[model samples]
Target: MSDKQLTELLSLINQRQDRLAFACKEIADWIDSQGDRPVAGKIRDSLKAVEADEVLVKKTLTSLTLERPLPRFR
Candidate 1:
């Protein structure tokens, strides 16, 4: 694939990841706003964990976009 296409794909991937991260944070905030401390803490922790994954996704995406494309498995 051409560099432009790869760049565009990476941009879209980043955008989607950003949205997913934002949604997770929003959900976590909503959960925190509710009463039930224990339940909210647990759920918030899980959501935070998932939100943290966005960092790894961004790093990997950057590496993939900057480096040569990997060979596809047959």
Candidate 2:
């Protein structure tokens, strides 16, 4: 891949991270707004937990990407 492609890939990775952060915020808001027992609340809480413990997710993504070859591979 050219330098341009690599830069684009890194930009996409950053965008993905930003999207995850946005998802976490949305879930947290939903959880806070729930008054009664709601299944959505459970899902929201789960998302919050995952967002709070993102180190594992980061490591996994990094390891997986590092092990994969670039698109230019034969």
Candidate 3:
């Protein structure tokens, strides 16, 4: 692939990361707004885990795309 294509792909990845972060924040905020309910705490904990996983995935993707060169196969 060409450099232009790689740049475009990276841009898209960044946009997606932004959107995912926004959605996760919205969910967390909604959960917090819901007063001290029995399940609210559990749900908030689960969302936290999901957010952590997202960060890991995004880091991996950024490393794979920006830090390392892509291999060309015959």
Which 10 residues in a row give candidate 1 its minimum summed lDDT? 35-44
What is the total number of backbone clashes in candidate 3? 0
Query: By descending lDDT, how would the candidates be arranged?
Result: 1, 3, 2
Among the numbered candidates, top lDDT falls to 1
State each model's C-alpha RMSD to the native. 5.0, 6.3, 4.5
lDDT by residue (tens digit), candidate 1, 1-74: 98768778977977986787677667767867776567666766776766777778778767666767678999
Each model's C-alpha lDDT?
A: 0.73, 0.65, 0.67
Q: Which of the numbered candidates is closest to the native, going by highest TM-score?
A: 1
| TM-score of decoy 2 | 0.43
Per-residue alpha-carbon lDDT of candidate 2 for residues 5-60, written as tens digits (9 for 90 to 100)? 66568658766876886776677667667753475566566666657757765665
TM-score ranking of the models = 1, 3, 2
How high is the lDDT of residue 11 in model 3?
67
> How far out, in Å, is residue 73 in model 1?
26
lDDT value, residue 1 of candidate 1: 92
Query: How well is each residue in 29-51 modelled by candidate 3, as lDDT tens digits?
Result: 67678764445566566667667
